[model samples]
Target: MKSSESTNTGLVVGKFWPPHRGHQLLLETAAAQVAELVVLVYANPAGPGPAADRLPAATRAQWIRELYRGDELAQGPRIGTTPLRVFALSAEGDGVPPDAAPDDVHREFVRQWLARQGIAVATVFSSEAYGPGFAQHLGAAHVSVDAARRHVPVSGTLVRKNPLATAAYLHPLVAAQLGVVPPAAIPRVVLLGAESSGKSTLCAALAEACHTAWVPEYGRTLHEQKNGNLAYEDLLYIARRHAELEDEAAHKARKVLFCDTNAATTALYSYYYFHRCDPALQAMAAVCGQRYAHTFVCAPTVPFEQDGWRGPEALRSFQHGMILMQLDFYRIPYVLVEGSVAERVAQVRRALGMVDDA
Candidate 1:
């Protein structure tokens, strides 16, 4: 809450449980009017279930800071306190309200917090029901920016209920929060296979051989989170996000990246699990075919070990067949990788025409 004496200062307030496109638009609009903008991410304990139910206030502030750190619009706005200071505001008295509305109480708390920090707010910016009135209470100009009609509206409730439905409307900040990055320049190579196929092992080897980056399978992480039994949609979402991370890593990498798996594998897995296909899965598979430069199919060479999350041998065998069918259907050329880790690494080098000396 350290104050800066900038001539034009604006304060934006929100729960920002998860900062989204709507938040970005409001901030963008406020920046146009102010030389400096102070974004206050508010946390209220009196209104909601548990404070933990919402995204942490610190995390929300981080999203705002990251979104504006190098962004064009953020260059002039002075969005936060520490140069790029996105502030975190919390209600006082355990956030319990005696009589006032929770929003009003939170606003009053914010004003007190700013005063304590020796900061003066000139304007309050927001896109919420309580924004204008709160601004007036603080002796600041009020600006309400509408998010419903401008761009795609993004809401935390919508995202929590249906991430895929709102994924398209998510801002870059939200994508980053969810570990998604935009496509990069490096070549993306995906490794496809069933569980216990050593795809992850081979990916690490290939990355080492080429001195490049690799994206580990997020499915395993998701599987662990779900206590072993994952739904078809969960697998599909992880696969799609894995591909996205690969693209992002590729951009940051020197030459190329090794992806542990791709969307085609996910689509086939979904089909195998549900005996049907979803349009999102299909679209993801199609997109993967165009994005990957090469795909390495790890032939099922070993028996299914009792990995904490892996299925039985029968399921692995079935998944293996489905993978092959997907490759044929997509018409994507894939080199079959078999044998030890060393052998797989050599095959990858040969495929990419990169010799040890090179």
Candidate 2:
């Protein structure tokens, strides 16, 4: 069932909207058998909405290249550096069956594209039920790694459905590919507050005034994507991931990173809503306190908007107090940002010791 001994190039095809562990396992297994691997990322612009939800084809290709750019593939006489080839395939008018099943049409189109590139595809790797038949039709061998029977065969659907439960199944490499790396150096100045506290607006102005980079809040974007029904756990996950990403971005910047919020905010938010905090959330808060050089608490000023995903203004006010209390308990240095937008931005620039004209 597993090819542990073989030396031939292979082709693996998938939508890989957001490549997960199952996909990575199949790719690694196939790479073991193949002398080289060509990963064909298929995108049908005219297909249903599900295909559109995947990361853009260009972004997916970048993640794949970053994942395998310097990785060593094989060992021994059969040992050689495994080179990963990422290709973007468009099936607009390639003479392929238009009404065929999406997967089938995609596989056939990919085969034709590869042939035109002068590259012979010996095998196709996948674990889906339809993969074997599709591979056979293309005259390429089929390699399927039955991860379904494994303990952690988490699917993209399952993760999208309940991302919190499957966070443990995420591989570091995949996380990095997804732009979720912990920063090598921590930002000295961090923002901590509840939703609708004008944290993002203030952070942006501060970053501009100080000539530093700002890590935009990812939760709001996720909220908009989910139409405001995102669970509290998803918010927590996004908060944690945001901190990791902020650190990564700040590591390369010359000045402090003006982050919108940190994991502590998530811990408080989850506890407020669920009546308890997840242990992982508590640990993350502890790590955050030690990671940041300074922390700023944004006071809830403007009336909260009941965006599809947001609660009422009264609830936001309560959450703001809870967040401040949590910050106090953690002993993190803090300043409160308040007043009009201009005043808040001015205060932030002053706190960070940046010279401003007005």
Candidate 3:
């Protein structure tokens, strides 16, 4: 806010609850015309949005970064050109009335906010009727992009109502955060198996081959960090955190997500160790049957590498059988993928309706 920005810099403000293609168009159109662009993200004026609908300001910044930079976004130092600057200010009831108010009132509110930041923006870009007045209040020129929505034909309200149905309008980042991963957009593919069944390896290979991304076993990371000293409550945390991780990874994966594990596996481990699992975890585990597009079990045919955390070498077969029994008990159908990592990857490709290179 208090830096050495030039006078030719531009400004764009919104409550980007979830960024859609329309929003992307506005930003891109504005960015191309300015030396630098400042995107100010604010909370809903009615009040803070529901937890599920909230998109953090920092995350919006990252979206813009990814939008403009692509694979070169985070690469070390750039040789030429300035980059976009993002700021999130959620000051509710700080004298700025709700967006439903007249343009004059909202304009003054934005002017004061920018004044506080020591920014004298040259041009204000928007896709709404208030763009001219809003810019005038800040003593800047106004550039309205597509005020009619003919170009993108999407809106925040339309997206918020039924995000999954409008998944195509949303950016990958927004869709993933809103849990709008429709099958045509992004499919959640879960891999299940007992310990040392090559589940993790298969997940990585499939992700790489499919040119997508995968979610690793969060519980395994915790186990290693805790040195295999997980307690009862940890199971519930693992189940919830694993689901969150899957949603987070969806933004990175466009085609399909090869998940290393799911809440069902967590509940099974909890019941195995404590003789019972949390009801909350059990409920979440039940959702796994319908949550995933495809379920593949990495067969324990290969040698069981004895990891320090695995309970015992003999428990592998028993645990493997138990997993199959649980799947049958719940009437959840799954494919039993066996053999080397490449062969398993090929099986997954076939399941995904992709050509198997192997």
Per-residue CA lDDT of model 2 for 1-358, tens digit only, reads 3355756678887666556667777777777778788887655552234535445555565545544432112221111356677775555544434434576666666677778888887888887888788788778888778636384477766655554555545543344333332334535677766777888778777777776678877766666766656564464456555755675676566567777777777666667667776544565666666557678888888667665566767787788788777877977778998898799887877776765533
The number of clashing residue pairs in each candidate reads: 2, 2, 0
TM-score of 1: 0.52
- lDDT string for model 1 (1-358, tens) is 3334446678886667666677777777777666667776655542233434444666667556645542222253244432334776545633423424676776677777778877787888777778778888888988778834456466767765655567655653354344333344677788988889988888887777787889998777776776766665465456545655665676666577788887667766676668776554565666555667888888888656776676777787788888888788878888998888898888888888787624
Model 1: per-residue Cα lDDT at residue 97? 36
| Least well predicted 10-residue stretch by lDDT in candidate 1 | 70-79
Candidate 1 ranges with C-alpha deviation above 4 Å:
1-183
RMSD of 2: 15.7
User: TM-score for each prediction?
Assistant: 0.52, 0.49, 0.56
lDDT of 3 by residue, 111-148 (tens): 88778888879999999887888888888999999999
Q: Candidate 3: list runs displaced more than 4 Å.
A: 1-7, 43-82, 91-94, 183-292, 299-336, 340-358
List residue ranges in candidate 2 displaced over 4 A: 1-186, 232-236, 356-358
Instruction: Compute the lDDT of residue 33 as modeled in candidate 3.
Output: 72
What are the per-model C-alpha RMSD values against the true structure? 12.3, 15.7, 8.7
Clash pairs detected, candidate 3: none
Selected candidate, larger lDDT, 1 vs 2: 1
